[model samples]
Target: MKILHLDKNHPLLFEQLSQLGFQNDEDYTSSKEEVEAKINNYEGIVIRSRFDIDKTFLDAAKNLKFIARVGAGLESIDVEYAESKNITLIAAPEGNRNAVGEHALGMLLLLFNNLKQADSELKQGLWNREANRGTELDGKTVGIIGYGNMGKAFAKKLRGFEVEVLCYDIKENVGDQNAKQVTLEELQEKTDVLSLHIPWTEATDKMVNASFISKFKKPFWLLNTARGKCVVTTDLVQALKSGKILGAGLDVLEYEKGSFESLFTGNDLPEALQELMKMDNVLLSPHIAGWTVESKEKLAQVIVDKIKQLYGFGDDEKKILPPKEYGVSGLGGFFFKTKDPDHIKAWYKEHLGMNTDQYGWTFWWKDKEGNDCSTQWSPFKEDTNYFAPSEKPYMMNLRVKDLHKLLNQLKEEGVTVVGEVEEFSYGKFGWILDPEGNKLELWEPNDRAFL
Candidate 1:
């Protein structure tokens, strides 16, 4: 596949794609107009927040199959329009989740302990330990919004801090041992500190206005490492000044550009931002929550790894697998019971175009990369106890990707997992009991291992 590398990125991404048989063109300096003019020439595009991928840009990229954003947040991209055109959007939020989580925690600690103020005072030759006294994080009820990658990462990091973390997401069944999932109302009522980890969308823009803050039962500390637009700057400033918000730590500002750099000149910044800059109770960073040095390589690696998975890039001995268009991709293995396995196998060989082995009939096929792969078809003895727990006479295996992700999703949806996943030399396997009591086998194949 031919890809357009729009924004500058680590060389490893290009190198990995090249190794995967993908031809890429680097045009980091090109203007949006120029890039749009020739966008249809490539099958894919890898970018950061160099420019917005709106409807017009989507229209220009008629031939684009995918858009890989190097970092998290697809706010700059028109997701609805791209979906209508079937252009897959891929982002690397997993790469920088830890960085963002750590940054958010650091900002919170800085605000809570008055670390920034203490350091500033000491440097100024003023020692006022009593005035700069710190507040304990232990026993505090911290509320987390949007418990996805960043939120979950933050929750994990907070485990040692001895805080009662309550997480609330619009989506339900997201609570785990790390944080107690609760309703937004419950979160607002009980939280001593609130941290935002939500993405910026139309529904979320200015979501945390004065009215939203007023919903809280008491004054609380605030932390936002998500998006600047999620919280209305003016509303937040007023809340902080009024002591409705005790302290605030923000890594992003609503007025920031799409590229997350300064949108306005120093003289042209919004009135609220100017006020925030002068506030002692507020801490601000230039949207660098996920901007760690380690995250640079991680982000690139994640995007490249995703690209490889999508295009069937690794393992030269095994061809790339076909993409599943529906719920299940293909039959992993088909099994049935018979009184006489050998007789049935001979009968199938005599009638159907089948070559049966001692164990089973292995159907071979080439992957997208023209590598070897096979699926097994076998007939077990009628009295075999392999399908024991269930008295079913047959068992079916389904092929899947990201096995753990699918398994977790199933569990969250309250599906009955038969047992834990078992690893074998050939692949990783798991079992689930369907509604009809059929023992279904899920396999994430390791084709190379079989070869």
Candidate 2:
């Protein structure tokens, strides 16, 4: 399949894809208009926030199958629109997690020790040891927000630091060995140091402002290696000025350029930012916490590996892609347990006009595409354990077009599909538990084989 490389990335990405026999098209300097014009020519695209992938872009890329992002953030991409079109998305957050973790630690250490100020003073031949006294990281409570890849990495790095780590994520069950899972209020009440590690999403935008800071019981130091807009700069500066916030170590800023490419001009800086720049207590970097030399190569390598895994590259060419149209067509079968299978079978045969055979009754039907199909009805013994895990007395199978694709959609919709898809000579079968606790079976029939 043809793949478009729209943004500048590591050379290893294209090299690996080419080795896998995918036609690679690199256009790092294309305008948005140019990209839309040629989007239909490729099956996939690789990007790193060059431009927005809104509904318009998705509509234009009619042949596009997948979008691979070189980094973790998807703020620039229209994820919902792409998902609606059944476009696959791949991201490489794991690649730069270590770099971010180390960078956050380094920033905190520098701030805590007043290292920057001391170093500058020493270079200028002024030795003021009394005023440059530093604080210890040991025995301090550290709060971590968003315990996904980046948060976990930061917690991991703090293992030997003798700090009490408390993690609060919007997601459930995210606590691991490195930190104790706690509520947001609990974190605010306990921590002396607060670190942000979440993505730039609607919910997280400016999540840390005046009101958020007021919830803290202690005057805490702040670290933000996550998205810039997560913290309201104005409120942060106010907090620092009021002595509510001890200090801040920011790798990202809310007032960053669109592409995160340029340093801010002094004349154009916001009033709060201008004040922040003059503060000795505030530490800043150009959002390069995850841009280490090692991470650059790791990011590209992870992307290539994920792509290979998704397409099953080199495993089997035929299984490289899932079926396109995934939808339910009709009922495949109806099953129920009875005290007397013979009696239920006789009743169905007598009252329902079903011509019962030895195996049971079969109702023949045709689909929208005029394919012949059949539905089966059977009654099993009351004590049967065919539905072993679920004690439901009955099971009904809905015929579907693509089993894997349907399962994927069901998962996305918050419907919990249970177990692996079971394949038999008759069809492929799967199961799910409804909110009411009924175990429902789904089937994609091998009608041609039966015929």
Candidate 3:
């Protein structure tokens, strides 16, 4: 397959793909319009936020099978429009998650200890330690927004610290041992430090405005390692001035250009940014939270692997053997309780890289002899009686070879069966109960029907 590289990456990407018999080409200095004229020639495109891939660009690429981004966010691309055209979108958030986590922790420590100001004073030969007296992070409650890859990584870094880590995500069941999942209101009420790890979208752009800052019950420190546009610069400066925000450690700024490679030239910056630069309580970096020495290679490798895997050219040669005799071959699905199903589906797609819909993730695998099979992983509303009679938190779905035969055998064995056997476009399904009274779903699948 033909592939086009919009930006230069590590040599391994080109070498690996070329070795796998894919033609590779590069065009780094072309204008967007110039590249658009020739995009239909290739089946794949690799990018790193060099320019916006809008509907116009999507319409031009008639042959594009996929678009691979070497970075975490796909904000530069029209993801919905491209996907509607059957073009797969890929990103490498896992590659740089650790780097971002470390950077966030470093900024938090810098803010808490007043390290920047203290170092500047010491360099000037001043010995006023009282002015730089710092507070500790031990007793603080840290709240994290967006429980995705970056958010989870940041929480993991805080595990050793004596702080209560709370996470507020749009999805339920995102909480882990490192952080407790909480409602956004509860997070704002109890947090002493708030860190943002969300993306830039219509709903999130300028989300942290004056009204949002005012909701916090206490003055709090802020750290933003996510998108710059998520917080309004004017509102942040106002909060800082009014003491609503104790301090801010920002790796990104709202005034940054779309490319994020440069800021406004000369003295053309807005008044809020100018005022922010003069604040002693604030720290800024050039949007390098996820840009580390190791992450450079990791991102390239991740992109290469994903592209290779998508095309079935991966290096994994381990063979999968199918079951010979099947009362139940393997697990077919796992459905559990959740407060919100749609939000949880959004979380799965954003964080775990699962392409999900209302019913949730359709896990596709291969049987022996390279035949395709499918399964399901979904979440139901907490109040739903789907797992009734036993009142269990979850239900297991087992894949069987024959639905009617298994139901008859189960009945003969004196097992308690629930409801009658049902058949749908995707498969035939039946319900039963184990001796412990847990509900189970049996499926004889038709993988092609769903596909």
Candidate 4:
């Protein structure tokens, strides 16, 4: 299977992929038209944020199978479109989770110990040992939000620091044996320091707003190695001014592009950011928490392993490449909605040969061969709002070998495949609406690279 490396940057990734036996096309800096023209010839494509994979690109690709992103975050990729096209998407956040954790810890240590200030003073030939005091991490309660890979790594590192770690995540069952699982309120009430590891989701944008910060019981040290927009800079500045927050170790800031360089020379400073810059207690750095030499190599390996698993490639044939995008992957239970749960369950059982269980009229089916096969379906009230948009239901994509054939089979079995076959640069795919108007995507790739 032919694989095309789209971006010219990240030489280490190219070197790793060369050892995997997959042929790489060297015309890395292709324009949109060039990529669209040649994408159909390749089975696999690795990208960075340099190119945007929109509907046009998806429609143009006839053989594109898998997309490997080298870092964390999917803000640049058209995830829905790729899934609809049946393109397997993989990312390498596992490689950098530890890096982020260590960076956060290092920044916090520097802040609490006044290391940056001391370094500056020493450079000026001052010997004020008495004034340069420091604090200890021992016996402190640290609150961590978004208990995913990065959050878990941070917790692991804190184990030897003699600190109590409290974690609060929207999803349950993330508690580790070492850290205490607590609600947001509880964490806010007890923490001496707070670190954010959450993603940039709709619910998490500006999550650390004014009211959110007001819940803290003490003047806590704040750390944000996550996305910049997660914290409201205005609210943080107010908190700092009011002595509600002792200090902040920030790797990101809202509108940081302007502050990082003198590019916007004449522009007015946002009131909040201007105030933040004047505070000595605040320690700021550009976003580099997950950027380390070791992490870069690790990210490549993680992406390579994911691609190998997705395509059922042999260990010897697996190739490591730096990714251009990043996202989360794991087995997750989904809540489906249907007008007639029983009928849908029966259809899946009879046509798809799926194993399903019912609770009242609702039915749930788990992939027979998967670990979590004991899935169930239950009835809901006629007016039940559980499937409503307000619940923010998840969209599941079932990867199929041949989307057209699968659609035909479902159609023959009296199931409605809602959408027409949409052709994209990546591949051809379609969608179907369940009994409750919930949309599920079916993808089929035209290449063997994603076998």
Candidate 5:
């Protein structure tokens, strides 16, 4: 099989793929037209974020079978469109999970211990060790937002620090024996620090808003290694001004496109962001939390392994198997089962303007502007048989066109959509739940919408 490597210069990945007996070609940089022109020749395309993989590219890749992302985020690839064309999508979060987790931990420690102040003082020939005393993590309570691969890695690192870890995720009962499961409210009340590890989604974008920060009874440290727009910068700045939060360690900023040094210069920033940079309590990085040297090589190896697993290239040679129950498949979306299908369907129909049939077999919905809302379902028993222990009711995200209008309509219809309608660097979305206690997500894409 022919493999096309889009963003060249990864010698490790090149050597590894060569050893796998696959013919590989390097393209240091390819224009949209050029890549599309030759896409049909390769069976697999490996890329970073340099090139966009949209419908046009997918249409040209007649021989394409798999699209391997050398990094974690799939935001650059049109995943849904690729899946529709029966192309497998693969990402390597496992490779950089440790790197990101460690970076987040390092930022938190540096901010709390006032390491930056010490470095500044020492450089200027001053000693203020007593004034720059550090805080202890031994008896602290940390709240982790997302419980995915990165979240697990962060929790594992926190285990060595002897701190109590509480996690709140939309996915129910993600009970790690090491950490306690708690509600968002409990996390706000008891946590000494709150770390965000969620993806950029409708439910998570601008999640740390005014009300979210105001809900905290104690001044807590905030850490976000996730997407930049995960926290509302304006509201976080307000919190910092009023001292509602003790401090913040941010690896990603709200609008980070240009070089880090250029973006943070003098007064050419949003008023709220300008004030934030002046605060010694806030620590910021250039979204390099997961870009360690070791992680780069490991990410390449991880993607190569995923490619091998997809084709069953070497069964005799040991390989890191994917989750046993959830093998890779075309994203026909996910399967969800509700015990009270009728009640759930009716709730969705009445509140969220969804349409349901008499037999409760199929369901549909329209946004306020009358766009078709994608929907799907299967029998509860059948789904349980397929997706065992994870049979609990959870949210299923439906792609939508107008997020704001739908959120307002749901509010008018007496449905308590969890959060406000907000735009992110990635997309726009909102959240709501059905009567049977299943969360529902609505999303509207933006630039880099595929991920």
Candidate 6:
């Protein structure tokens, strides 16, 4: 099958897909019409908000089987029409949910502590503590709209805070222990902070307008990491002016272009957005709530995994890279020392889609002959003795087939062997030293059992 890439992503997305025998091409600078003119040539396409995949585009894609969007939302694509044509719309909400969660939390904390304002004042040499005094999140009620992957993630981040979390979603039974399910009316009545996490649907377009804001019993801070069109910008500005809304932290804005790559393409900024820019209490960012370095790679990986799964091609079903008959096949794992191992692990797992646990990330692939393989990525405590005998800050674990045989060969060649063979259910491990005295780990893996 031929796949067209409308927007570039991490190389792994292409690399992995190409490994599945798919012919891939990139057309980053082509117009939508130009792409449509040649759409029938490809069986699939990968995108990340470069342009809309409307009915017209779908109609032109006669042979297209799937549209794999590297990002979460499919609003830019005509989902209904695509589905009606039997085209699979693949979205990677799972990929960036954690990044969105962390970003929302950061924005909320910045607003609550007046951190942005305080930092600006300090930089300008205007330190007025009383004027910049902030509210505490500990006693507040945080109401989350649309309790899907993104909403649940934001609520989970609030677990450390002494705040009540309420979620309102059209889907029932979505409330978890981190947040209580509540009606929209009840949430409006009690929430001190309202976070929007819904998609851009007809029901949500301009959903948070004057009527919506007026229904709230008291003023509340607003956080929107969702679609910009969900909130009416003029109404939001009016609420901010009237103090009906204490403040707003918006990562997306109504004035954004369809592509979300530029805000106002060679045009003057809208009046409402201009007003928003001048407000000290308002915090704004580009549509980047989920645009973290880690998320870039994760999003690509998710799209790759989904595409592979869709076509019955996957890590366990095929070889990730060709294996050697003798010697190290590839890098088995990578480990490092960190001051905060737990936090590091959580960060990697959340932002990088590592799925790291107590031990760390176990990457699954396959060797030739379709045998499952595993590679580990982990971080240890700063003062740990894990990298013992050698004071190196890191270790390189190499995957080999015959650990004992290789160790014997190295010993005959006068190479230093650091340890005896250690066997486990998943694998056998042995340590050796390089000429420069840096310790290296060798693993004879039983990957099918390890997984």
| Model 5 spans with C-alpha error above 4 angstroms | 258-267, 315-451
Which 10-residue window in model 2 sums to the lowest lDDT? Answer: 314-323
List the candidates ranked by lDDT, beginning with the highest.
3, 6, 2, 1, 5, 4
Candidate no. 4 TM-score: 0.64
* Candidate 2 per-residue C-alpha lDDT over 101-216 given as tens digits, one digit per residue, 9 for 90 to 100: 99999999999999888888899999999888999999999999989999999999999989999999988999999999999999999999999999998899899999999999
How many clashing pairs in candidate 1? 1
Q: Cα miss at 186, model 2 (Å)?
A: 0.4
Worst 10 residues of 3 by lDDT: 316-325
Candidate 5 vs candidate 6, lDDT winner: 6
- Model 3, position 314, has a per-residue lDDT of 35
Write candidate 4's Cα lDDT for 1-451 as tens digits. Answer: 7888775435666776667677878665668788898789988887655566788988888788988777776655678998988988877779899999999999989988988878888999998787779999999999999898899988988888888999999989898975778998899999999999987778988999999999898889999998887999999998998889989999877765421323223478788888888887898877889879888788877877777677666664554531211211111234455667778767877987766666432223343344332222343434555434333344454445666666776778776676489877655657666676666656454542332
Q: What are the Cα lDDT values of the candidates? A: 0.88, 0.88, 0.91, 0.75, 0.77, 0.90
TM-score of 3: 0.72
The worst-scoring run of ten residues by lDDT in candidate 4 lies at 322-331
Over 4 Å off, model 1: 265-267, 314-451
lDDT of 1 by residue, 1-451 (tens): 7899988888898998898788999998889999999999999999999889999899998899999999888989999999999988999999999999999899989999998888888999999899899999999999999999999999999999889999999899988899999999999999999999999988899999999999999899999999988999999989998999999999988888788756644567778888999987899898889999889889999998888777665645465454533234567788889999999999988899799989779898987768766788999999997775677899998877656877787788888888789998767888888888888888877764333
In TM-score terms, candidate 5 sits at: 0.66
Encode model 6's per-residue lDDT on 1-451: one tens digit a residue.
Answer: 9999999899999998888889999999999999999999999999999999998999999999999999989999999999999999899998899999999999988988888889999999998899888888998999999999899999999999999999999999999999999999999999999999999999999999999999999899999999999999999999999999999999999878888998967677889999999998999999999999999999999898888788777466565653435467768789889999999999987898789899889888866767777778989898987677679999889888788878888899899998689999878899998987778998888763332
Model 3 residue 96 CA deviation (Å) reads 0.4
Candidate 6 Cα lDDT to native: 0.90
lDDT of 5: 0.77
Candidate 4 positional error at 288, Å = 1.1
Off by over 4 Å in 3: 265-267, 315-451
